[model samples]
Structure formats: C-alpha cells, structure tokens
Target: MRKLSMAVLVLFLLTSFGIAEAAGSYWQRMAHGYPNQLVVYEYVYEYVSPELEITARVPQLAGASDVNWQDEFNASIRQEVQDLVASLQEAALESLELEQVFQAFPYVGIMDFEVKLNRGGLLSLAIVTYTFTGGAHGMTYYDYINVDLTTGRRLAFTDLFDTEAEIARAAQVINEKIAQEPEWYFIDQFTPGLIAADQGFFLTESQAVICFGLYELAPYAAGIQEFPVSAP
Candidate 1:
C-alpha cells in the first residue's frame, strides 16, 4: 500500500508539469466583447503493471483572463485524479484476485477530459472514466466542470437556474423529450429525477446539455443520453 501511494505521488508530480504524451491544443472562445483563445494541456497520469493499467487525462487551461479560475480548476481536478487513482488501485487488487481464480482479463482504468462547450461567457469541460475489471464490458462514468468566464465562479444547476419554477420547467422539457423516445430510456430513472442541483451539464451556443450516464436512463446500447435544454 505504501509503495502504491508513492507511485501515485510520482504520477502527480510528472503530470503537474505539462508532461503529456501529446502536446496540448488551443481553444478560441468568447470572453467579454473580444475573442478569447486559451492553450489547453492534458494533465496526464499513467500507471502500468502486470495486473492493471491506469491512465488519466484532465484538461488544464492557460492564458485565461482569470488566474484564480485556472488555479482553482487545476486544484480541483488534481484532487479528482488522486481519488480516481486510489479507487482504481483498490479495484485492481480485487481484479488481480479474480484473474488468478477465474483466469479473467486484467483490469484497465482510463479517464480523459475535453472541452465540451465554450460560449455565452461559460466554459464546460467533460471528464469521462472507463474501467474494466474482468467484466462483460467496461463501464464509463462522466463528470463535468463548468465555469463562468466573467466572475470565474464555478457554475452548477442552481447557478444556471434561479428558482424552483425554472427547475420544474427544465424537468418538464426533459420529460417531454424522453417521451418522444420512450423506448430508449427508463422512466423511473429520469421521471422525477430529471433535474438536480448538481446534474452533469455543458453549455452550447444555444442550449445546455444535460447528461446521463450508461444504464442510468437506458441500456448500455443507448450510451450516455444527453438532452438539450434551451440555455437559460
């Protein structure tokens, strides 16, 4: 366990310094009245062994007007990466045991992030993780980090919608959308639970994308269901 901790620490140290297999990209978005372009780097970490492999990629921004936003976003993502590595380490132990007993496939964990939206004075990043521990197939999960470019405030459902009426209205929209394709979703999962204060979402030019994970509202075949709500 101590050795594993040391390895995770080393992984963090390496990724914190713009150390990615591939160099970062450039993003041009709207900020105030002018064009805003920021450099995007992949904060990557990797651990490979006989029993398991883990790779993490979080997008880090540079050249933003708000330095505080950049620092806070970086810190929060680093913590998330740390927690994921620890969780994967624990899962890998069980996977190793299962592999020896059942002769199953080795474990694999991967996390990557991308710029999902950058408009309307808001920036949304999508982070996804996939893990396979001797299963029929791997499971994928998602987390989104959204920020207000003007105030550098982290935005949530509450921040986007001001009142319960707005929330209910949004849910109604989602419900209607789901009804349009009832065969592809689970009513019980998305009915009353459609809108939450901290739901995964991203902004676009005209609407906000509300996200659902695999099997949350439908079968894995449906993939992650993203419903668009007219941006508020």
Candidate 2:
C-alpha cells in the first residue's frame, strides 16, 4: 500500500512539472518572438516634414462677395478637412499596412476615392465622393491635407497646393499598386494552404495576408480575430 501511494505521488508530481514547463515556454515565446513564425506585412512609415494640405469647401449662403461669408465657409471647410486628416493620421499610425486605411476612412469626404487598377488595357478607379447631406446651401468648406505615402511625407501648408482631382488620383495610384503586391507575398505563397485554399475568392494579396494573420493570432487574441474560414 505504501509503494502504491508513492507511485501515485510521483505521477502527480511529474504531471504538474510538465504543465508548468509548458506554461513557462508559452509565456517565453509570447515575451520574445514565435519560432518558425509566418512573416506578416507591416508598413514602415518614414516621417517627413509636412508639405500639402487638402481642404473641403462648402458653399456659403447669401452672397459669395461677403468677406465674412467666405471666412465662414473657409472655416467650416477647414474644420471638416482637418477632422478627416486627423482621423487619417491616426489610422496610418495604427495600421499594419496601407490597405487598412480604406476600411479606416469610409466616411472621409474624399470623392471618387478608389485604388487605380489596370488589367489588360482596362483602367479602373474606386472613386469615393462626399456630399453635404443637409444644411443651408448644403455644404461648407474645411481644411485640406495630402499624403505622399511613397515618401511618408504630408502637406497641409499653402505652399503645397494641389487640386482635389490630383490628390484623389495620387491616393488611388498608391492604393492600387499596394494592393497588387504587399510585403507578405512571399510569406503567403509559402503557406498558401493555410490562407488561400480557394483561388476563386476575390481577395487582394494584402487582404489575404491579413486574413491569414488573424487566423494565426486568433488563439492568443481576445476574440477580435475570429475570422470566417468558410463563407456562407
């Protein structure tokens, strides 16, 4: 009976040590980096001095000749555009990649906002536009800002003047090229079976990386990374 009890105690101690060792190893990986981990695309923004500012102007009431009218219109427009710029800056700082800014700024008043895409002689742009939904004369003017993502520089200064059309065009071009080839292409290609099992899925390469990333990190995430593996 003493021998039997001794055996039971030894088994319990061994099991407890194994569990503790596993938990310690997991925490160590969490503190450091994962081994044999998949490479994920993370945007490396190069900070530069401000250059251009994009403003959205809302038409004023009564007369365009009134200096106060122009001032008010300009003020309103500047406020709105500044708000947009703030939100965009926040998103850029927080995002893992440039493609994330699309979902981040759905309500930003940029019109005809689209990633310029070219396929077999066909050019396409996802133009997003913002219109005043209500109010006197329907709209007002706000501050403007422009981003040169290629250089990681921004301009909201008067010296950096650019037409709305030009700003939209530049953003679209950047978005399109970024969508086609992200930093995660090689990583995703190496582990295609885990992320892109179906070729029919209309996912951009960047999106595929994100999808796979959520999958790999979900176990440690607080349910925010619960992604659909198979769509209905």
Candidate 3:
C-alpha cells in the first residue's frame, strides 16, 4: 500500500509538470532591414494552445482568411516592419532632397523589440526604442502587450484589475514609491491624480509595473521611471 501511494504521488507530479510545460509557447527572433539604413527586429511566437488567439491585427494579417494563429502573428509583425521601413525611407528621401536647405546630418532609423514576459498565458513585450529619420535625440518607448492565452484577445489595463479601487490603491503605492526617490522626478508636487489607468503598465507574477516615458514625468536625464507595485 505504501509503494502504491508513492507511485500515485509521482504520477500526479509528472502530470502536473507536463501540463505546465505544455502551457508555454516557443518564440524565435527575426529581423528585416533596408540596405544600409533602417532595420526592424521582432519576435514571432509559436502558439499551440487553442484557447489563445493573437487579436492584434495589421493590413496584411487582416486580409488572410486561411492562416493559422502563428502565421497571423508573423504576418502582423512583418506588416509592422514594412510600415516602419517605408516611413523611414520616405523621411530619408525627404532629408536627402532637403540636404542643401537644412544641411542636417544623414538620416537613419532603428527599431528593436523584446519579449519581456511570456508565461501563464499572458505575454508582454517592450518595444525598447524606435528612432525615425532625423531628430536631436531618439525617443525610447515601452509597449506592453498582454494577451489572455485562454481567450486570445489583447488585455487592457482594466482587464488585469478587478475594481477601480484596486487601481487607485496601486496608483497610491506607485506614487508613494516615487516620492521616496524625489530626486528621480522633476515634480514640485506629486498627486495621485497624476497616475492614470490609461497610462503604460505591465505585470509580473507578484507586481504591476507602472511606467513613464522619458521626459513624461521627469527630465530627460531621469530616463524612464518604472515603479512596481504589489499586485492586489
């Protein structure tokens, strides 16, 4: 009887491990570029779960009728790459045409992204930086894309929280943390109202990361401010 019980427990553990392993999807990095000018880098995920769908759409992915979820995902990334490259090319041509007028430096564009979190059916990504044609400085931004693997739809900030009260609490916590490092921000006064639900945010297993773009809440020297609050 003791041996039988031990065997049963081992079987249960193995089954649980199998389920966990099967829940995760694999991904691959891909890059596209234009001669010596613009380059776009992205990641493509291989989704195996029937419950999840990639709902983010682009022109190329929208027209396809028979493609699987993985194909649609790849197509969407490709469409984004094409759009980015085209925009940069247009700007580069304009810069060349106006080279004598403005006498500005040569134009080049760079876009790169990474998968920040991909587990338990929720996937998040950060589009680290995207710098087009010409500017005094390149703008760095974060893109958090969280999707419900079970539903296959992109989730908004509200979807992750149960109530407005929870959001308020999270905001309060973030504000408090920022206040502790007052030098990190440029505000003479910090208010809870400053933190909005529509603002950029992402989640980890234990915390929600609320972020601000460069110069949004502070000076450019301060860089991006990301405050992680305990998940409610």
TM-scores, one per candidate:
0.74, 0.20, 0.63
Q: Which digits, one per residue and each the tens of the lDDT, describe model 3 over residues 1-232?
A: 9999999998787544333333332221001111111112334422211221121222122222224754666566666656655565566666566564223344433445655555554455555545534466766666665544334466676655546686677667766866788787777555557765566776565566778888887887888888776644
Writing each residue's lDDT as its tens digit, candidate 2 over 1-232 gives 9999999998787543233233332213223422211111211112221221233333222222234633564465445445655655564444424444334233223422222222111111222224322232222221122222112122231111134543344334434443455442323222222322221111111211122222232222322121212110
lDDT of each: 0.70, 0.30, 0.53
- Show the lowest summed lDDT stretch of 10 residues, model 2: 200-209
Window of ten residues with lowest summed lDDT in model 1: 21-30
Predicted structure 1: lDDT: 0.70
Residues 1-232 of candidate 1 have per-residue lDDT tens digits of 9999999998776544323311321111222222335566888898887666788888888877668868887887878888877887787777666557323455778999888666544567889989887657989999887775655667787765557776776777778877888888777334434566578887655566778889877899999988777744
Candidate ranking under lDDT, highest first, comes to: 1, 3, 2
Q: How does model 3 score by TM-score?
A: 0.63
Q: Candidate 2: lDDT of 41?
A: 20
Which candidate achieves the best TM-score against the true structure? 1
